[model samples]
Target: MAIGITAVAVPLANADVTTKANPEGIDVSSYQGSINWSSVKSAGISFAWIKATEGTTYHDSRFNANYTNAYNAGVIRGAYHFARPGNSSGSAQATYFASHGGGWSKDGKTLPGAVDLEAGCAGLSQSSMRNWILAFYNTYKSKTGRDVVIYTTRSWWSSCTGGWTGMGAKSPMWVAHWGVSSPSIPAGFPTWTAWQFSSTGRVSGISGNVDRDHFNGSAARLLALANNT
Candidate 1:
């Protein structure tokens, strides 16, 4: 070890996440713990989706805290619900989500809530799972007047839903693919609004690895979607 030499910084994981895209963002639950959102914003994170609720009753304990802090830190804030079709009716879940902190606004900054559909639908047949997803969307849209984003990997969606394309022309996708250069989304949603490219991403302000994401189009489009314009 030389005293005069400067050591180069090495990331703990997924150092190549920046190479995946330019205006990227993150998604977090209580998993990341307390985040230094100002530092996160200063590090070039453009937006964030925080876990808000799940099923018909359980809600993320840290959702409101993260939501307010992200807004105060100048990060575009959004909420997401971890689906549990087996726990209760999908409409009930949607209603529960909105009752919590999952409402969308026309502020041109807040993103509509996204429904995470994947392993939760595991073991259920494609037909039953599709019905549940439809039930969720129907009630969620009716309540929020905003289209919800669907998050799933191509394989998970295909296997669970038999590649169902029923939500045509409405739902945008937020596909997740860890450690990959690009995400492969389900056929149901032709284009994606966001791509969660890596979960092992190292970003400033967050102590551990965080999920990294890229918006499909420009930031303007994102704001437009938020505003529902």
Candidate 2:
């Protein structure tokens, strides 16, 4: 979800993607307002990641509500930061994310915090952006005790980070590739932990299109990842 804004038109989700995997989930933010998490869970959503903070200053206004409600509805929940690396230092952004809403706890259900690295890095030079991402990654890992997931499309990661392989050794990946048989992860990551396959997904509770995702492992393995075990 985009930071500090509401979505006007989110296309309907492709229902066909669910056939390829079990234990699928969704990612959402302030864009889909007032979601009925009960319906979402009932519709077979096993997990969720909510937008918590962006850059170093902005917080998702709907974070607490969605976070608490989603947990109460029995969805394994996680938090993510919509990164703006060009705007602020990654350490500050990590600290800001942890302070407001992006911290992850090992309750056996909360996945590691993620950095949303989409087009937010536009205009920044490749080397500076790489260093910026490292700063965020190290700080977030130190604070949360879990490696952050680098969420990006293959083209974007390749274009911005120059396909730096060091990032994948410690950081897990969340690759977004819409309408493909398999996610085209960049060269760095060994395997993707999560894949956001579609942005225009329709579920029970969300009024508009929500992002659909899939974990690469079984439900037990997913819990272990969340527990950081």
Candidate 3:
């Protein structure tokens, strides 16, 4: 979800300490290549969001290995889909994502799937974009019986969706804002469920830069989310 955009960092004096208290996580894709899941778990990473499918045709080549290995290493993980609204209908993309690695189970280690919505509005109007996203969320929920997590930046959400607040109650927000003490919340969401605070974070298992995240709760709360309790 780190597309390399710079934003003004929020001036929170205790942001670093406050963020560190929450559960730590990361999001990875084929760009990270092979990873040592054991080392990653040992590094105190509680969860991960692995890229799964993009649009209706492209699937992340490393999704299977990362998905299986991360689970085996005892890291709670979920899959994510990159939105390509210009290429296909949201329903089709959601179906593709679910059919691929985005399916969820009741097992304690699998988190619900997430949809990345950072693309440039896909040439659609605000209303149309909102509908596309709703179609995706509805289809994904029907397929997995879980509300899909929505990932986007505050700027993109405001510009593209006209800061629509409808999804705040339905889906959890995973806001991405790099180099910030605190992430900027989008219009509808009262607070962020997950925050991708840095795109250039390094982990022992990852080769280069990986996206660093924090679940906005404790370990038990994260498990509750995974188990849907």
Pairs that collide, model 1: none
Question: Per-residue CA lDDT of candidate 3, range 1-229, in tens?
Answer: 1111122323233121123347899999999999999999888898999999999999999999999999988888999999999999999999999999999997778889999999798899999999999999999999999989999999999999999998988888899998878889999888888999999999998899999999887666676677666
| lDDT leader | 3
Candidate 3 similarity to native, TM-score: 0.91
Better of 1 and 3 by lDDT: 3
Error of 2 at 215 (Å): 0.7
Per-residue lDDT of candidate 1, residues 1-229 (tens digit): 0111122332323112233233689999998999998899888888889999987778888888899888877677789999987777778988999879889876545788988886556467889988988888888899999777788888878888888988756788888887767777687676667889888999999999999998875555555555566
Scored by lDDT, model 2 comes in at 0.79
RMSD of each: 10.8, 8.8, 8.1
Q: Whose TM-score is greatest here? A: 3
lDDT winner, 2 or 3: 3
List the candidate numbers ranked by lDDT, top first. 3, 2, 1
